[model samples]
Target: MKYLAAYLLLTAGGKANPTDADIKSLLSSVGVEAEDERVSALVASLKEKNIDEVIAEGKEKLASVPTGGAAAAGGAAAGGAAGAEEAKEEAKEEEKEESDEDMGFGLFD
Candidate 1:
């Protein structure tokens, strides 16, 4: 993930084709030692690919993923007023439990 982030940062900064050494230097500047195998692999894979096109393709693929929430909402809508009331009750119960937990303090507190 760090390698990919560094690559994207370099590309965004006008480095059309960042080399493994460039990635290493960027990582090292922030106290991270770049692994040769990972850097080389990333560079080799992206060397021949257009970064913009690759990102566009990734976005296209991500668009097809199911978010899961929509279907549940659709089903609830189909169930009429009963489902709406149940949903409201569930939400209120959840809020009450959350507020009561740790005397209104979050987990870290």
Candidate 2:
């Protein structure tokens, strides 16, 4: 990820093709150590590609991914049912308590 970020940063800075040495230098400037193998791999992968087009392709691929909203909604529905039961029991307890204290006097009062 760091290697990718460095490559992207150089590309954004008008370096049409950032070399491995450039990536390492940029990382060192920010107190980060760039791994040579990873830097080389990233540079090679992006060497002949347009960064903008690559990013657009990645976005399209990511858009097709499932975000688990359906699973979360189902879990929430199940939890809501259990919560409703607990609320009903609490309501019954409150009703009994209220009946015994109709004069509206509380411990703090």
Per-residue error (Å), model 2, residue 8: 1.0
> lDDT values of the candidates?
0.92, 0.89
User: Using lDDT as the measure, which candidate wins?
Assistant: 1
Task: Write one digit per residue (lDDT tens) for candidate 2, span 1-109.
Answer: 8888888999999999899999999999999988888888888989889999999999999999979998788877888978778889999999887673777677666
- Clash pairs (backbone) in predicted model 2: none
Candidate 1 TM-score versus the reference: 0.65
Worst 10 residues of 2 by lDDT: 100-109
Check candidate 1 and list the clashing pairs: none
Local accuracy of candidate 1 as per-residue lDDT tens digits, 26-101: 9999999999999999999999788999999999999999888899888877898998899899999998877846
